[model samples]
Target: MFDGVHLGHQSIISKLNAISKGKDLESAILTFWPHPRKVFSPSDDLKLLNTIEEKKYLLEKNDLQHLFLKEFDEDFRNLTGEEFVKQVLVNKLKVQHLIIGYDHTFGKNKSGDFSLLKKLGPECGFEVEQVEAVNYKDLNISSTQIRNALSSGEIISANEMLGYNYSITGKVVHGKKIGRTIGYPTANIEVDAIKLLPKKGAYIVDVFVNNTPYKGMLSIGTNPTVEGKLITTEVYILDFNDDIYGEEISVNFRDFLHEEIKFESLEKLIDQLDLDKKRTDEYLF
Candidate 1:
């Protein structure tokens, strides 16, 4: 899967699992790394729903027997539709049956399709099956849709499509210590460069530290109130305080609180934060 591996992907994978079980075959996912988009446009600002590690973890949870991760580069991108099937699917994987998404395409110049796979399946000694798209709110569920929802600050809709809460995993970093002065200490998060972030705003989130969940208010934006231009993500965990710098954590976006605003003063910012905390408490509890 390219990104989120949302419900549509899960449907295909679930079909693969059922088919594999019925036919006494092993199931595996053949996914590419470095994303094809990143390969074609090296400098493009491409963000992904899940990092490689995150994708691996999710796939493992689905009880996949094997994960065939291929590094995508210039050479890999040049392979023809036939070469990919012959060299990779048939020879390497010995795949007896292939389950693909309805709109799935592969090979050089995106030439491969379900029809090509079906035509070649008999010759290659394999079966080809395609899973129909899953729809939510009359819209086809896709990584792009989820990404767009998140970019627009529609966390609830994004989570609904994902079949899980949208989250970001990162390491806690040091910040300018501004929140502390305002009586709300925060943990600055340093996330993966390629990881897709939700819209810049404040959110009601659940912070996962050492496998424990803590309610928190997350901020994602430039500190306009402080006249700072650098975009930062920080979380103020409620009812908890301890040094956690350098520790890895994950923040699950539960609800959108409000947009980032430039308060007139620090006092105004604190006052807004108090309201934010109250809203978060009401939502969480």
Candidate 2:
């Protein structure tokens, strides 16, 4: 999976484009859908960084010409390294110059590695190269690291690795008008269940409404102060006072302000909201 298409992934794609252009071969990316873990370990509840559409949108902005999303099922998983190289890479894609990451593996049980590809390249009439890992502040940038950063509410670190802001796109849905009573009107957002959400916290964000950007603060957690049970994603856009129910918007996470806290009373909650707003304005504006 190109997952976040973080810096490391971008390095590989950059190398792929350079080599393909030098060799005069078409550039492309081959990824699998339903994530292999989803097929083999359904109980893991694996959240993905990008939905398929999001992946396509991200990849389309890159220099590559084609993106092949192969369905990964039991049958596809059972293919041996040689068989996969022969059937998929050689026959189907007609791959001539293949570029992969330094740690990439494929085929049954992940038996395929750089060595395997090197061996098969000559026999299969193709060339192979592996891009070195990309690093930031001496930290190896990878999808796993980005996920961990987001899971820990380290939005700044995650964005550094991603080379862009991590964003959530969803539809505005009606929420209990609790925030309005507290003088902070909010819009409830409903996103795809499988999209990986960062840790439950308050974040400084840039909310996009009708393609226009506005400063905002977002909360991703249950309304514990209000005795709510289900987790909710709500954003209070600063200076934006409009009914946006059913509107599609995107929120680009900037920095994590604080973690969710349960207040003793509504007065306490409102006080915290005031502080949050103050901090958000200071940081954003």
Candidate 3:
């Protein structure tokens, strides 16, 4: 729905769980898939921090039992604010209590908000609870801020706002084998499909391979020294070796160490990689 399921959305969901107490009420999340923006009009700028599959997996960590994956279409978008509530919440889910953020909105033209919900709650037989805005050291927490921080490579503050580490998921693809030729075997990951990638640099990463976690270092850029031109995510697993071909890996980026730089020679690049490997060892150990 939003760019990422950052700390602000986590706060709202936490509030919903708190109000439920010990009643054992079934909690559900209704979010659009393929993104509303993508459906309405596609843009290269509309990069998603979490794919819908990843979002569903993350939501499983919360108290929510299920997610209603709604396809955003012009028809669904045409509904007025009140009709949306009538169909989705009242008639369909029979929702007894609805929890949302203070500024959250739905329906056509975003005619729904905390104020509108309050005006209509009495007739709908539901109680609307709007959680107060989340704040971080006197600053408001928002998805937009997190995205901006990521685009600027301010991952520390961005991860703080996400309440978790910065992460990405992708499928392993075949690369030019230039890293293997240079003695540092790497697993190349394709990242441009629908995920938001981090800054081009070296990162201490934890890679989930076949459901097992492994410490790794990732390089996020085109290799100028190796004569590679396309941007690729190349990961070197620490003290681990396996044929991970065609395996999908979920990588959690721990820290941004440096920007990707072009070395004058391949030998210099290899020398720099030695230091990179050692720094990665220190990070994960």
| Number of clashing pairs per prediction, in order | 0, 0, 0
lDDT of 1 by residue, 1-285 (tens): 548878998998899889989999998999989988888988989899999998988877887898889999898899988889999999999999999888988899888889989999999999999999899999999999999999999999999999889899899999999999989999999999989999999999999999999999999999899998999999999998889999999999999999999999999999999999999988843
Error at 38, model 2, angstroms: 0.3
Worst 10 residues of 2 by lDDT: 276-285
Give lDDT per model, in order.
0.92, 0.91, 0.80
**Native-to-model Cα distance after best TM-score fit, residue 79 in candidate 1, in Å:** 0.8
Which residue ranges in model 1 land beyond 4 Å of their true spot?
Answer: none
For candidate 1, the lDDT comes to 0.92
120-167 in candidate 2: lDDT tens per residue? Answer: 999999999888888878878888889889999999999999999999
In candidate 3, residue 227 scores what lDDT? 69
For model 2, the local distance difference test gives 0.91
**True-structure Cα RMSD, model 1:** 0.9
lDDT, ranked from best to worst: 1, 2, 3
Give the number of the best model, judged by TM-score. 1
lDDT of 3 by residue, 162-279 (tens): 8888788678888888888888899998764777777788888888898888888898888877667888888988787788888788788777778889999989989988988888
TM-score of each: 0.98, 0.97, 0.92
